[model samples]
Target: MRLMIVAALTLVCVAPAVAQDFTAAPNYGDVRLAPGFSPDPHLVVVQAGGSIDVDGTLSNCSGFITSAPDLRLFWDGNGSLDLKVSAISNADTTLVISGPNGAWYCDDDGGDGSNPSVTLSSVSGQYDIWVGTFDDGETRSAVLSISELSSF
Candidate 1:
């Protein structure tokens, strides 16, 4: 039970940022890290069987932005995941993704506050990503959009 508790605690980005409804993209579901999973920060294998989408709104996420305890994402397929912020609101956001053949991305209000996009290209593995407020603990609507480009 303790191991299950730990694993559950590890994968979720909780105490979110807003109060609106969230419609996650297709292939979306709760993802968990299984036992005996690789300690490799390079690959996050899925456990049980569910997939989190590339795009969705995170609501009421309460916390300050910090470099540690970021979320992990695994592409596991060839193509790029264009991770962007706020296709739905005017929340100022910062997105950082690292991994996959030296594809390290970080963006802060690159679009307009209107938006910003950080794309990870040539992906075929896991990645670690985080969404942060331009200011800490700013409870507002933050939308994350993930698009699969050149999917083959």
Candidate 2:
């Protein structure tokens, strides 16, 4: 009887450790722009009829420098959406949207380079977007905004 109790307690203690919560922020990595990329990589999961707000800065220079149009957002899925940023130099930033099947419903490539927004009518699961870098020989950075109306 004592052995059974100890085993149960051991399982209870270790179970939670194996189940990690990615939404806690620390689990997510920095949104970094690849070589010649702008905004970098940003990913999240949202439910149907949900929406996400995105606002950030980008540039060839290091650190958070907001000049105007620095990063761009692109969506490759049907139910997905994006808020893209552009500069006077017309820097190229590729934001690819991809996720699991069936869950990939809607999307939007947020353009205008200013402040952009997107609403998901019906979609779920994990989605990813890669921010490209401008060809100014400077590094680019971007801040991500996300919201989930449904269960993660």
- TM-score of candidate 2 versus the correct structure, residues matched by position: 0.28
Which prediction has the highest TM-score against the true structure? 1
TM-score of each: 0.44, 0.28
Q: Compose the digit string of candidate 2's lDDT tens values, residues 7-108.
A: 999988766221112223321233422222332323332111101111222111111111221222223334443322212113332222323342211122
Steric clash count of candidate 2? 28
5-72 per-residue lDDT for model 1 (tens digits) = 88788766563432221222212232333222244222221111112221233332222343331344
Q: What's every prediction's RMSD, in angstroms?
A: 14.3, 15.9
Candidate 2: what lDDT? 0.29
Looking at model 1, which ten-residue stretch has the lowest summed lDDT? 45-54
Candidate 1: RMSD over Cα atoms? 14.3
> Would you list the C-alpha lDDT of every candidate in the order shown?
0.40, 0.29
